[model samples]
Target: MSYESITLATIAEKTSISRPSIYHYYDKKESVFVDLIIQEYREWGEQMGPLLERRCSQEQF
Candidate 1:
C-alpha cells in the first residue's frame, strides 16, 4: 500500500490507530517516515552485504 506523504490525520484514518498513539511512537510524521526509510536501508544493506563480500573475494582470487 503506497501511502504518499501523508498528514497525521490521514495516517490515523488509514491505520485505524488513534492519532495520539501514533504520536506516542513518533513525535512527528517526518520522524515516522525517516524511521521507515532508515529501516529499509538497513535491511537492504544486510541483504546485499554477503553478495558484496563474495564479489570482493572473487576479485582477489
Candidate 2:
C-alpha cells in the first residue's frame, strides 16, 4: 500500500498491537516506518555480509 494511505489504525491492525501501545513506543506512524526500514536493512546486512566476505573469481563475482 502507498505511504499516504497507511494510518495508525492500519498498522495496529496488521501488527495485532493496540493503538495506545503503539503510541507509547512511537510518536507517530512515520516513526514506526523508520524503525521498520532500519530493521529491514539490518536483516539484509546479516544475510548478505557473509557472501560479501568470501573470495570469488571475476566470473563467479
Candidate 3:
C-alpha cells in the first residue's frame, strides 16, 4: 500500500477509495504524504533496529 510521490488521483484510482475519504482521514494531501513518509521511516527503523544493534555488538568486539 505504498503510494509515495504519487498524485492524489493516482492514489485514489489505485486504492479504489474516493478522494473525499482520503481527505476525511488526512485532512489534506500533504498530511497524507507526510503520514506516509513517517510510516515508512518508522517501518525502516523497526527493520533496521536489530541489524544496527548487531553491528554495534560486532564493533565492540
Candidate 4:
C-alpha cells in the first residue's frame, strides 16, 4: 500500500500494540514513520547480517 494508506492506527492494529503505547514513543505520525522505517530496517539487517559479511558475486547478491 502507499504511504498515504498507512496510519498510526494501522500500525497499532498490525502490531497489536495500543495507540497510546505508540504515541508514548512518538509525538506525531511522522515520528512513527521514522521509527517504523528504522525498526524494520534494523530487523532486516539483523536477519541478513551474515550475508553482509560474506563475499559473493554481484549476480548472487
Candidate 5:
C-alpha cells in the first residue's frame, strides 16, 4: 500500500493491535513505519551476519 493511504487504523487492523495500544509505542503512523523499517534491517543484518562470517570463497558468496 502507498504511504499516503496508511493510517493508524490500517496498521492496527493489519497487526491485530488496537489503536490505543499503538499510541503507547508511537505518536504517529510515520513512527510505526520507521520502526518497521529499522526492524526489517536488523533482521536482515542478523540473517546475513553469520553467512558473511563463514570462510566461503567469493564465488560461493
Candidate 6:
C-alpha cells in the first residue's frame, strides 16, 4: 500500500488489532514499513536458498 494510504488507523481496522497494540510493536509507521521490507527479504531467501545452491544453466537462471 502507498505510504500515504497505510495509516495506523487503517491498518488496525483491516487487521482488527487495536491501534495501541500496533504501537506497542512499532514505535512509528515507518518502522513497520522497514520491518516489512526485512521480512520480505528473509522470506525470499528461504524460497531461493535451494535454487541458489543448484547449478542452473543460463536459460534456467
TM-score of 3: 0.62
State the lDDT of candidate 5 residue by residue for 1-61, as single tens digits: 9989988889999999998898788888999889889999999999999999889998988
Model 3: per-residue Cα lDDT over 1-61, one tens digit each: 4546676766677889998777668655677678889999999999988787764555663
Specify the poorest-scoring 10-residue window by lDDT in model 4.
22-31
RMSD of 2: 1.6
Ranking by TM-score: 6, 2, 5, 1, 3, 4
Better of 2 and 3 by lDDT: 2
User: Tens-digit lDDT track for model 4 on 13-53?
Assistant: 88899998977887767887787799999999998999889
Q: Give TM per candidate.
A: 0.69, 0.81, 0.62, 0.57, 0.80, 0.83
Candidate 1, poorest ten consecutive residues by summed lDDT: 52-61
For model 1, the superposed segments whose C-alpha errors exceed 4 Å read: 1-5, 56-61
lDDT (Cα, tens digit) per residue for candidate 1, span 1-61: 4456677777788889998888788877888789889999999999988787774665663
* Count of clashes, each model: 0, 0, 0, 0, 0, 0
Winner by lDDT: 5
Better of 1 and 5 by TM-score: 5
Query: Candidate 5's C-alpha lDDT?
Result: 0.91
Give, for candidate 3, the lowest lDDT window spanning 10 residues.
52-61
Model 1, residue 37: distance off in Å is 0.6
Which ranges in model 4 have alpha carbons more than 4 Å from their true place?
1-19
Q: Candidate 3: where is the Cα deviation over 4 Å?
A: 1-10, 56-61
Point out the higher-scoring one by TM-score: 2 or 5.
2
Residue 41 of model 2, lDDT score: 100
